[model samples]
Target: MPDPERDIASRYREHTGRKRTYILTGFVLLVVTAVLSIAVGSVDIPPQDVVRTLAGYSVSTNWDNIIWNVRLPQVLTAIVAGAGLAVTGMVMQSILRNPLGSPFTLGISNAAAFGAAFSVIILGAGSTSSRVGDAVTINNPYTTTIMAFLFAMLVTAVILAFSRFRGTSPEVMILVGVAMGSLFTAGTMFLQYFADDVQLAAMVFWTFGDTARASWEELGLISAVVAASVIYFTFNRWKYNAIDAGDETAKGLGVNVEKVRLVGMMFASIVTAIIVAFLGVIGFVGLICPHMARRIVGDDHRFLISGSIITGSLLLLSADTAARIMMQPYQLPVAVLTSFLGAPTFIYLILKGRRI
Candidate 1:
């Protein structure tokens, strides 16, 4: 007989090599996209100038200001937020053993929206300026961000507590999320109804996801949270893989399914909440990227997680860039573009019967 064991080993190595290549390709594409995003804004700087600026060479002061002060922050935000949301989606799907588990689906986004609206309306943190042609201004962005974060966390706490105290299944927790999302949406509408025109405009503007709002300090905070969460998921990748096999199988493999699930959910929720508080509701990247990565990298969390991070970053950054340059001086919200891009793809996946 032929050497069957040797053949198996060869096949395994080939498979691993292929996955690595895919990840490498994703990284390369992400780099190109980031460069294009930084270069092709209203004041289209040449690629060489863009590279020189990044390499600490002196471009013109105007070019330097546009690159460093305006476009670079948004590009960095897109990368971080995209990776954060996608990885968070991956963790939620793995822990819950549900294909549809994401921050958008779990009501976390809605809760954050409600909180921001509360700050704008009841807290009087939102106003409009006649001098700037009635441009909506958040009088206290910190208060709105804080309120959004707290409300998002509150929803997570409720879901965890119900699961722990009531001994409900992951499916039940999802149902609870649906209920919570509806309630928050109603609450947002309630506040909107009683608000004056200025406050209403401000509230509406806050919900439209835009990366330009984040400054260097805000980006630093988002980066820190996302970096820590990614590290945690990387360390616990094996446990997530075991859990994916089933709770009973995971327990036999010495994985604490309940504890791991709860902790993982909490971390994922925190990542989603922070992103939403800053960027508004950029949906579909989380829901779509994990599935796309799994199709390419298989169910192994090691490759799957890395794949998701790259895919998510590329997708969101590309969308944001398109939004910026499509209409020239007038920019559309990145969130609108994402929803438009994501909805059709999502429906197609469902039509193809993508089950977890």
Candidate 2:
């Protein structure tokens, strides 16, 4: 007869090895997608040219400009924003014990939308410029981004404050988040109702999440925050894994369940707030990527976290690339494509009955 202990050890090793392979495959695909995104834009620079341009050798000034000034920044933004949103979503789902938990689940996206509309309509930061043929333009993006960040953080603050008084149970947090989302949606509608044609157009435009809007400066800030968040999450991976077993079980395992949940939620919210403020609410990435990673890697936070990051970056980068080339002169919003991709995949996941 086979030794039972050896059999179990072999099975464990095999499982771990498969997860590692999946993660490595995902990261390789993510890099390929990033390269394709940089190369397959309106002008369609060759992959060789892209590599040369990136490596400080100029193929031509025009290719160099397109690669460096336009496609590179957009691709970088998608990778960073995708990673941040996906990781945050995974953390929220684990900590809150809710399959539906995401950055937007806590009302951050809706609140940021309200703040952006306020700046566009009330503050007159966004206006239609006749010089650009009445195209909507944000005259002061700094004000809009700042306001959006503040309002998103406000929603987080409310949730945190409530958690202080009431216990940090998953049910209570989900209920509060849904209520807050509804409140902010109503406020955004109220602002839209009073706006004129120009302001109304601007507000609507701001809601369409676009990675093209980010510059190197904005990308730097996003990268810094996301890098820091990834570090924190990595350090607390074991605690999250323990908590996933169940609250009481986690406490028995010496995990400070409440503190871990609270701190994890706060960091996730900050990542969400910063991304929404700059990118204007790239939906579905935060929600779907975690589930996709979970389906592949199982509940172990070790593989799941890195899996989510790679999956998120790959999905968003592919969507952004499609958005750019779908319309020659006019690009669609990245969020629109993400919703298209996410909805069907989400329905498929439901049909398959994959658990969180």
Candidate with the greatest TM-score versus the true structure: 2
All models: lDDT? 0.89, 0.90
Residues 1-356 of candidate 2: C-alpha lDDT, one tens digit per residue: 55576778888898899999999999988887887789896688888888888999998999988888899999999999999999999999999998888889888999999999999988899987754322677889989999999999999999998999998988777888889999999999999999998889989888889998999999999999999999999999999999988999999999999999999989998999999999898999989999999899988999999999998998899899898888866788899999888899988888896454
Q: Tell me the tens digit of each residue's lDDT in model 1 across 313-341.
A: 98889999999888766788899899999
Report the Cα lDDT for residue 308, model 2. Answer: 91
Question: Which window of ten consecutive residues has the lowest lDDT sum in model 1?
Answer: 128-137
TM-score of each: 0.95, 0.96
- The candidate maximizing lDDT is 2
What lDDT does candidate 2 reach at residue 273? Answer: 93
